[model samples]
Target: MSLLKKFATVASGTLMSRIFGFTREMLMAAFLGTGPVADAFNTAFRFPNTFRRLFAEGAFNAAFVPLFAKEIEQNGMDGAKRFSEEVFGVLFTILLGLTIAMELSMPFLVSTVIAPGFTSDPVKFENTVNLAMIMFPYLACMSLAAMMGGMLNSLHKYFAAAIAPVFLNFILIGALLLAWAQNYDPLQIGYALSWGVMAAGVVQLAIVWFAVRRAGIKIGFRRPKLTPNVRRLLVLALPAAITGGITQINLLINTNIASGSAGAVSSLVYADRFYQLPLGVVGIAVATVLLPELSRALRGGHMQEAGNLQNRSVEFTLFLTLPAAAALLVFSEPLVRLLFERGQFGPESTLIVSQILAVYGLGLPAFVLIKAFIPGFFAREDTRTPMIFAGISVVVNVTLALILFPRLGPTGIATAEITAGWVNAILLLSVLIWRKHWDYDAGLIRRIPRLIIAAAIMAAALYFSAQYFETYLSRQAGLLVQATTLGLLVIGSMIVYFATVFAIGGASLSALKGNMRRRKKAAATPENTDISA
Candidate 1:
């Protein structure tokens, strides 16, 4: 399959998952609002969720896929299977031990690391501890699932792993519905949701596990041992894990600092979820597909192919990401109000969340670009450099967040995050260009400014459109009227953006079609990895 086609497959799945996730958040807003229970639930889930991103999504794949691809190239399927089993054995044992230790230390972790501010409120603190302990085991399941997902991606069977995450939202949404039906209190609902998260992890893991089996790699557990291969994976993964988890790391920082204010954590969480829609769909899909493809190209000594992959991925990233960022920046308040300003989520909450979402929107491009760039280093087995850059970004985030939070509150923390994000992205891109690892073709250089212009035009249109539809989007309007008006505004803005983009040569139908179409000759020749064909 062509690279663009692979991206679409993964993106479609991610989009589905994000839609379900959006629904889940809306339900949570109605049920818990930005209350103590909401804060506790978000905090509980954040621990496992952060580690899941750190290990399963980014770190494990950065280290494993290249080596696994190399194993296939040099030693064939048998060698790949053996390598996978070795890593699995060690990973499972470590995750088991880590979960046990974390469970035992849950109270201390909640008080010190997770949310120190909650300590003053003994009930909230204890609830957080209990919820975290129930949910922390999710990390083990997801880490194992991520390993299987890496295998599926390496084998070029992308859909299964891509679709696996949808289950998390599905299970959580079901739990929310049950709570609403039974009319559970906030604390009871929090427990139900935490248990739902734990269940989702198992379901997600099972989905990928079966997918890997169907793909003909049955990864079995053996006694844990640190063989050379496993040892090397560890070395590479430790830093990659940290680098991969940079967003969550920043969030953790924000959480610790923002936790001092009531409703601050929940506000940030809502805003983060809104921006994550674009980031997850575009950024993650690119990273997931780009890493393996780039790794294989570099491994096969196809420098031109590697360079083309990077340039095209950036083009793709900006093409989708820029406009989403524009929309968020221009229409944040209406969007927030439309999505969440019902029930307990009031106008005050909407205003605060919108402010934070707008700030996050400014960083959206940088956030997605990081996904596009980091694979350049990981593809070449250079993890430490990105890890170092991640550390610098963390420092920037910590310093700025501390300075700004006192004055700006949640928005201040968001400003620091975006600043940190841009720093990390610029540093990664600069190193790639300086080292001659990334090649910028004329198409990317030319289209970037045009893409920016196209997005600017769309943002202007959205700004006015929101004003024109102000009455319908206001609280006086019924939910149906607000939803319908918002949908039209979004659809209309998208039409304007795409028309302007294609007309201005920012994006081309012919080029996208050509990239999506598989060439007969390239398909006949297995060694030809030229993505442009």
Candidate 2:
């Protein structure tokens, strides 16, 4: 598939998932607000989620997909299948034990490890523990799902894995509505959301399993053994886990500090959700599609092709992520208000969440760049270097959060996160250059200034459009009007940004247009011909 087509396949599904995720969060805010109930729920959810990112997104996929892709390239389908089964067996055993232990020690884990937010209130603390126990098993389910997703991604089947997240968001939305209809207590609703998470995990696992079968890859449990391939996977995955762990520790530190501040944790969660929409859509989509492809190119010694792919991935990521960052900075308030300002969510909550979103927006590009760049290292099986940079970034994040949280509250935490992201991105690039692993070609160098110019135009256009449209988005306005005004601001900004880019020679309209045409043509071609070349 063409790069653009692969990107579209991943981006389209991710965009849908993000939209549903937004809807789910909106319903959650309406029902729970940023009150103690919201606090407990967000806290409980983050516990399993932090680990989910560590194991599922961070450790497993980072180490697994590239290795799996290599096995397929070197040994054939059966070799790859055996590798997957061995890893799956080991993962199942480990996750089962971890889940049981975590569930049994739920109270202590909630009060100490996860949410120090509950320390001030006994009832809130207990509710958080209860919800966490109910949710901890989700970690196991999602871990397996992520493993399945890694397999699908290695097989170049991006759509199913990308769409799996939408099911999760939809399940949560359903649970929220059901809770509302039943007039469940706020804490009860939180538990229902927890159950929804588990359900989503099951759905995602099923989807990917079916996709794998269709791809003619049969995966099954086998006798657990530390075979050579499994041992190699463990060795590589350990550093990834540590790297992921360091990053999670930074978040946990912020969470701990936010815990000390009333409602700060929930505010950060809401703000993060807004930023994650773009991060998920652009950053994650690129990482998901690029990693396996990069792995194959590198293992096959196709350095030039790998470099070209890397450059294109960076260009594409900037094309999408820059506009998203601009929009978030421009319309943080309206976006927050339109989506979350109802029921228990009040004006104060909106202001706080919007502030956090703006702060996160400032670092959105850096975050996306990290996603695009890290695959360069991971595909080459170089986890230790990224781990070192991650450690440094964590220190930056933790220290800044500690120094700023006392002064600016949750917004300070958000600012610290952005700063840390930039720090990490710079460090990664510096090391890559130092090692001569990655260097921008003349074309990439030429494109940088043009991209920056385009991004600046986008920022200016979005800012003014948002200012102009705010009056039409009054607090008492109907939801339709509020949504329409928000849409107009976004659409107008996009038109202005594109027009400015085309006028100023900051972007190539014809090149992009032609790329799309090529992708459509390629997609229409026979599958055998598509792969043979």
Candidate 3:
């Protein structure tokens, strides 16, 4: 299948999952709002969620897919299956041990590291620690799921893995509804939600596991051994894991800073959810498909093909990212209100969340671009350089956060993150260019200006449109009215943005349509090999 089509599939699924995730968070807002229990739940949830994202989307995929793809290309299906089983065995064992350790230490972690501010309120601290322990098993399930997902993506079977995340939100929604039906207290609801997270992890893993088996590959467990391939994978994955986990690490740093303020952790969580929808859909979809494709291209010595892919990937990223970023920056308050400001989620929560969301918007494009660039290094198994760059970004993020938090509050934390994102993106791009691994093409140079222009135009329109809807947003308008007004604003902005892009000759309707279509020839696979692989 074409990379464009594969990306669409992954993005489409992610779009669905994010929509479900949106609904799930909306329900949580109604069920708990930014109350102490909500704060506790979000705080406890952050640790597992951070590492899960890295394992599922970043670190594991980076190190595993390229090597897994190479195994298939060289040694065929049998070799690939054997390698996968061995990797799974080792990964599962490690995940189990880690889960146990985290569960044992979650209380200490919550008190000292994860949510130190909650400690001042003994109830909040105790609840967070308890909730965190309940969800700790999710780490194991997600780690195994990541292994399965990497294998599926490497084989070009993206649907099941892509859709697995929906289960997490769906299960949480069900749990919340059930809790409401039972009139469970907020703390009870929090525990229910935590268990729901663990359940979803198992469900996610099972679906992908069956999908792999259905594809005629049976993954079985064996005694963990340090086979040469496993050792090599660990060597590559350890640093890649750390590099790929920069987002989580930065969040941890920001969480440390945000934890000093009551409700700040939950505030960042809710605000980030809005932008993560776009990030997951556009940036992650492209990155998921790009990694294996780049690995194959580079392994076969097709630099031209690899370079062209990188350029198109960047173009695709900016085209979607710019509009989303503009909307977040311009319409963040209304969007936050339209979606979240109901029940116990009052105006104060809306305002604070919107501020963070806007700051987050400033770095949205950088976030997507970083995802686009990282594959160049990972495709060549060069994880350590990105690790160095990530370390620098972390230092920058933490230093800035410490300096700004006292003055600006949670907005300051968001600001540090955006700055760090840009730093990481710039460093990654410079190294890629210096190493002759990547450079911008004319297509990129021409297209980016138009994107910026389109986004600027959209931002102005959205700002004005938001003013029109301000009364509906603020005066406790009914859900339908708010939905309609927000919907119109969104639809109108999109129309203007695309029209501007097309008129400026920044994008081609025909080329985009054609790119979405399947070509008559199948993409070339890596040359079959006889090496042990």
Q: How well is each residue in 300-363 modelled by candidate 3, as lDDT tens digits?
A: 8877778877887888888889999999998898888878888889989999999999999999
* Candidate with maximal lDDT: 1
TM-scores for every candidate against the unseen true structure: 0.98, 0.95, 0.97
Clashing pairs in 2: none
Off by over 4 Å in 3: 523-533
Q: What tens-digit string does per-residue lDDT give for candidate 2 at 1-533?
A: 67666778988999999999889999999999998988888888888888888887788778999889988988899899989999999999989999998888888877787776677799989888888887778888888888888888898889988898899998999999899899998878988998888888788888888888898888889878899988888888877766645445667778877988778888998988889888888888888888888888788777867777777778778767787887788778988988999999999999999999988889999988988888888898988888888888888998998899899999999888889889989998888788877856665566666667877787887777666666778788778999888887777778876776567655566566545544433222122111110
Q: What is the lDDT of residue 450 in candidate 3?
A: 85
Error of 2 at 166 (Å): 0.9
Q: Show the lowest summed lDDT stretch of 10 residues, model 3.
A: 524-533
- What's the CA error at residue 349 for candidate 2, in Å? 0.7
Decide which is better by TM-score, 1 or 3.
Answer: 1
Question: What C-alpha lDDT values do all the predictions have?
Answer: 0.90, 0.82, 0.86
Task: Tell me how candidate 2 scores on lDDT.
Answer: 0.82
lDDT of 1 at 309: 82
Q: CA lDDT of 359 in candidate 3? A: 91
